[model samples]
Target: MNTLYFAYPGELETPTGGYGYDRKIIAGLEDLGWQVELVPLGAGFPFPAAETLSQAQTVLEGLPAGAQLVVDGLAFGVMPEAASLACGRLDLVALVHHPLCRETGLSEDEASGLFESERNALGHARHVIVTSHATATQVADLFGVAEERITIVLPGTEKQDFAARGSSGKLKLLSVGTVVRRKGYDLLFAALDGLRECDWHLDIVGGLDADPGCHAALLQQLSGLGLTDRVTFKGAVAPQDLSGFYRQADVFVLASRYEGYGMAYTEALAHGLPVIGSGGGAVADTLPDGAAIYCGTEDTGKLRSALKLLMTNESKRLDMSAAARRAAEALPDWRDAAAQFAVALGGVRR
Candidate 1:
């Protein structure tokens, strides 16, 4: 049986989309009879301390010669030297959810450093797997990797019953993602604040602990706008409970600054919730026409107008809900994604 060593940062069970993709892919690979090993590197990655780098190096070195090693981009981007050391013996595959440099709230210098480092690290890989076509193009263009060397394995959505729209008169908007700067919860708050007269309530379901500072700032902004009563911060829900949030919500909104693959948006569509989000990164590819209302990340006026229309116009909302369901039914399940992943890996052996 073939063995695959997967290395990633933090706990594998983290609630973020990138980690979720890793976990699901791992499970899928195992189901296909691959002997997969999961290696968790310590936190503070892609910007690790000296000790973290040393530890990662040790982990990579310890793998058997000629082992098939897959490194998540979050850690691999900044570990060019370590990856280069392993590339001589191991078949290195870089699994990039997205480029680390595109993360929000980074200085130009920081972004440039990450971009250059990632470009170098990816050069050592035998193959690169990205979660979206948008990210594949990004790697080819920005990192100068050839397009044929990259594989696009889009994220899969679980098949679920359509969300039962709440008839509570008020529009229940749901936003799901970590409460970090990248997810753009602050922008979502600002957009919703301007539509106070639209009779809407927002439920943000994500981890606040990922970035306590961003969480605090969002809370302050909500208080300042007196929307404390209108919004509820339901930090990270249980898997079962998350489905409930999706089922009860009338619409889904996430104004993310960038996404390699916005799993939350796909999950929302799986539950037949109309989405409202920025047209950045891979979102345009993930969501279909008539299913989403797209705007620029900073276009609060456009988002507000979209929200207001969805809130008051029942006919339009229903049309979007139908479109969302259609899109959901067309999405590939995890099994199909895994098969594609297997094919991608097969090419590396050739």
Candidate 2:
């Protein structure tokens, strides 16, 4: 049997959302009768830069001739040596959540430079898979790669048991993902500031990653705005408990500036929770028409209006809730994702 290696240099069982995409892809591949090797590399901040690069190089060197290697774009993007090693290795491919270099809040010149480097690095792959068409277009445009060279595989939510449960006394609002600036927890706090009088509580479930300064700043902003009591931060809950949280939430919101693919948005819809996501990026792709309200940007007034409409109008909420559930049911499973992966890699070794 042919072997495939899925490489992610991080804690294998960590609950961080960043690692989920790679894990899911690996599982999908495995289910399709492929002999999969999951190679977990580093596990800390600053990510053992020099040592990891050397170790990754060693791992790539060890792959059998014609074996396929699937690298997480987040880790692979920085390791130029690993890219070189991959070039020599058999049939290298990449699964990019989004180009790391295209992240929000970077200066245009800096973004442009990083984009160029990422385009070149991604070009090294025999094939590229992105989570959304939004990301695919960005990569194709930036890298000048043909659409045929890339494939879009939307992330899938592992099916969860959704027992019938009544909502908590307060109108519960939930947001999951990293506590980073791009996740827009700050905008969420600002929106909460305006809805202080409403009988609602907000829960943010995500871990702090890469930047502790942003985490501290978020806490300070929450305190300064007097939202500390109303907004709860449950840092990294287990997967089993996540469904309970989703069940309790009356609505789910992703206040992100952008998403390569908003998996949480889909997960919320799967649980029958109406979503309020910003309009651009992958938000439109995730939320079906009328299943969620789409805000243009961070206008607290706009968010406030949407929140009031959803909260006060019970009929509208229930309508969107049904629509969301239907949308979730319509999504393709992981097997479909893997089939697409196989198609993309058809020209390369099996």
Candidate 3:
């Protein structure tokens, strides 16, 4: 049957890449004639209240017999009891953006607990869909999911004309992602501080509420580093506004400490913006060679040098911009991503 229920936490319209991925995939599936029902499990996922967990569990346990259920890892990881019960009566698929334990700012105990919970929950999945090859490896090695049971379906990119530099005198550097510790904005700030002599204005496009302490620290860091005037935190923006930001950008930079598969990086490539970023997580793997200049994740000096190279060398930036456009051509579109997802779903065993 071409029918499935997609269960996830939070509102579907959240401006994060993960949510955006879900939205596009669901829409693509619908275009392909799949009967997909979205199940909003709850907003406080992965750490929902006791009652919320109970309610989610009840909902899962009561789904029609022999139904196809695909649960997002954020909510599924912490609900092993529901997963264990649901798998017996349904073909349960686990859609993991990344393993929960790898998130930054978690205590060792919390990390360990999440690891155990995710591992337990994943054990019940008839099949697993991950966003990148690196994440599939992590699921197999760290979470004990068999490699044969996992499928890597990457995020698709929209077609965009090449990004053009704005009329502003300073180079426009763009960064996209939530203002959280995992994104390495602290390291990015330090790196940019060393390049203060360069003419650049950074526009950070992301939500500031995901990690309040991290956002507050970043604001304080910006002030202490004397970058308050050079940086603008535009906050989460609508898709149209974000596209405008991309069009006006000279270079796209992000120093994410880890990522399942960086949808933002691919977006920048699609826009044909020269890229500067770290080799953390799957980012290096995501970009084709020459599409970006990468540095060590925690090396402020190296990141600064990479940024300066792109900022000061228009010739090199042009070459990378061309490469970015070339790389984007090889990336999957939404229709391809949806087809890959459907194939992955076909492998699920009840």
Candidate 4:
């Protein structure tokens, strides 16, 4: 009864925040004495090819009868037919990081389709696990899920050694997330373009493989703004390598249009780095008041101002860095996150 199947898209070790959450939650559940088995659902999820979707359905159907299934929202939100078909044989629990319809790049038709499918899909789920209050609200209000069916288990932060910033005269800025349109890399580039007079360098640590079109467009914008030398796209790096980027950075920033829980922001705070961000959606609650300087995603002028305040004013940055550490001290670790998940699953079992 303690054994559960965790169905996710592609590899569990992937570097993106959603995959990373899946990995940590699995480990935490294991620590809680629950046996978790990973089921790969192939790749290109949420926009998978027809064959991929069919194969994913087959994978789910192949699981043992009445197996406890916790499916990642990336693929789960699209499977109304599969979910309905499996109703009597499988116990379905959806881990919805966010509603698929809310992704920024979708057209009206695409968004409406996702909304309908996810709403229909949720009707089959016994419970929904979300990472934030914002996402939980979205599930209940926008996705037509009930309040009693939702569980909010916030993303946990790892305790890390405080970043010992270097003596380099130039400010080192770090931005972490997949290089996608939703992350607002375009706005970040434009805002930094206005502060060309300052001695600053940006290191974007993220995977470029997720969205080729977005990555290509970002490259064009970077070149257009004459930032080829100012910003370095480190792509995705190993966790050990990423730690070095965090340790050397003076400030952390990402102009994300939205976030489910903003795991990157919390990771930044854990390293004691002051953050500059839009603090969109759940991110506003993810980061504490004194830990970050936030601006609206569309307000490049204000974003530039926040960037300037952190870059030119060392004292203010350091003050926020201290606050970031204090705030991070209060966030839950993996064990706590897993315990929350366990409670949600317990309800399903009952």
TM-score, every prediction: 0.97, 0.91, 0.97, 0.97
Q: How close is candidate 2 to the true structure, as a TM-score?
A: 0.91
For residues 171-228, write the lDDT of model 1, one tens digit per residue.
Answer: 8889999998988877778888878677888999998898899999988999999999
lDDT scores of the candidates, listed in order = 0.88, 0.76, 0.88, 0.89
Candidate 4 off by > 4 Å:
164-167
2 against 4, candidate with superior TM-score: 4
Sum up the clashes in candidate 1: 0
Q: Give the 10-residue window scoring lowest on summed lDDT in candidate 1.
A: 161-170
| lDDT for each residue of candidate 3 in 117-174, tens digit (9 for 90 to 100) | 9999999889999999988989999988988899999999998876554335689999
Error of 1 at 204 (Å): 0.5
Off by over 4 Å in 2: 43-48, 105-113, 159-168
Candidate 2 on 188-227: residue-level lDDT in tens?
Answer: 7887787777788888888776568888999899889987
- Tens digits of per-residue lDDT, candidate 4, 1-350, equal 49999999877888988988998999999988999998998888898899999999998899999788999999998888888877668889999998899898999999999999999999999889999999998899997788998999998899998765544799999999999899998999999999999999999999999889999998899999899899999999876677788888999999999999889999999999999888467977776899898786567888899999988888888889899999999999988999989988988873
Could you give the C-alpha RMSD of every candidate to the true structure, in order shown?
1.2, 2.4, 1.3, 1.3
Report residue 309 deviation for candidate 3 (angstroms): 0.5
By summed lDDT, the worst window of 10 consecutive residues in model 4 runs over: 159-168
